[model samples]
Target: MNEFELIQNIFKASVMANTQGRKDILLGIGDDCAQVQVPQGQSLVFSMDTLVEGRHFPFDADPVDIGYRAVATCVSDLAAMGAKPAFFTLGLTIPKSDPQWLAGLAQGMAELAEPIGLTLLGGDTTKGPLTLTLQVHGYVEVRQTPLRSNAKVGDDVYVTGLLGDAAAAVPIVTGEVLVSNERLDYFYDRYWRPTPRLIVGMALKRVVNAMMDISDGLAQDIQHILKASNVGARLEADRVPISAELRQWQPESALSLALTGGDDYELCFTASKEQASEIQLITQTLSLPCTKVGEVASEGFSIEGYDGDISGWQHF
Candidate 1:
């Protein structure tokens, strides 16, 4: 298919990509450029992420997972800033115009977009090796958005949801792991389809002193917070949450994954001691597992009981 045909047929024509009659979108696909309206009294939040075959995922990974993951990761950034998902544009490159793959990608993205009320704005398509880039835009109350640098000393460090499942899934995806069962399926799904903590982040924005999502890994990602806030941290290794499935699948390696494994897509935040009860109430009310793992300190970073080798995910 030609470029225009691919855009109209695979993307613009898909029900998932078109948000019919959306008042906020002045123009979407089929236009020279997409246009949108920022709501009054709200600040716009935007993030872009690129995924390349072999670098970001296995070359033969499911196309649907690829589509879903691209959007999910972009929205995760919005969640970190405590913003609502609004609209997104896609820049997709493929070696050839494959209808089956495009259909699968559209289906996967639509399933995710429909639930979150995300509208596909517009973007570019090119003939090249497979790579996907998505730019997500959202909004939050003016001047209330959280940042990684806002962590304060005396703040209790917390994380929403378990960690390390996605990191462990890497070996499975690469065929390095021999195990197969519920544990394998769970990890595989976690890596492919991460649950962005949007609601939890939006709820905790006004309450937390600092906030960020766990994309690179707990140890490395948390350093961004510490350096930005100009403070240190001492995390209780025992308090770090690990899933039972991961523990059973990798008894010796699970702890390290939970600590340094990337791709959890969960939110890590800090609040003062006085707000601990309120934090608990918020998580409990939402039925989301929020764990207190450490506190912001005035010195250097340390995770008690973990002194072994662990590093963050790096493109280099």
Candidate 2:
């Protein structure tokens, strides 16, 4: 089909299904330029991410999972900022317009975005390598949104959910490893369908002094908070949470993956020790595990219980 036909039949239809209650979206698909109404007393927040074939996903990966991941990972930025998801615009580049593949992608995007009430505002489609760029928009209270630059010394560092699973799944995704069906499913979900931790993030906005998502492994990502806030950290290496699935599969490397492996999409945040109880209460209400992995320090960064080179996903 042609570009207009492809969008009208597939992408536009997907947007319509997800845009029902999105009053914030003034003008969505079919417009020359989409318009949105930012909530009063709140600031607009946005982030864009690009996923390319072979780099972001395997060439043989299912388009459904790819689409879902494109939305989930990008929306993680909103969660990191403690923002409520609003709408997104997509920029699609493909070598060819395959109707079936495009349909699966649309279906997958809707599956994840519908429940969250995130709608597609608008975007562009072009011919090129297989790549997808999603720019997510959200809203946060002007003064309440947490930032990386606000962490303070003596604040406790915490992360939501277990880590290392997605990093471990990389090998499997690349056909470099094989495992049982159950384990395969777990790792695949971890890699391809990460939860954005939005509820936890919004709840912790007041509780945490600083907040950011762990896209590039805890070791590398935590340092970002430190640098941005002009502080140092002392991480209890053993405290970094690792999934049972990953520990059982790679006991020797589980810790490393938790520390240096990327794509976990979990939130790494900091809060005053006095707020520990409140943090616990909030996470408990959500039934999500939030673990204390470290504490802010006066000067330099260090990881207790292990001495190794600290590195993460290198985009370069």
lDDT tens per residue, model 1, 1-316? 6656865577655534557767778777776997887888888889989998988888877888888888888899999999999898888898988788888887778767768878778888888999999999998998889989989999999999999899999988878886768667787789999988889888999899999999989988999999999999999988999998888878998889998889899999999999999899999999999999999999799999898665788858
lDDT by residue for model 2 (80-172), tens? 999998888899998888888899999899988888878877788888999999999889999999999999999999999999999999988
Q: What local lDDT score does residue 177 receive in model 1, on the 0 to 100 scale?
A: 80
Q: Residue 152 of model 2: what lDDT?
A: 94
| Candidate 2 TM-score over all chains jointly | 0.98
lDDT of each: 0.86, 0.90
Q: Which stretches of candidate 1 lie over 4 Å from their true place?
A: 1-3, 15-18
Q: Judge candidate 2 at residue 299 and give its lDDT.
A: 77
Model 2: pairs clashing at backbone N, Cα or C within 3 Å = none
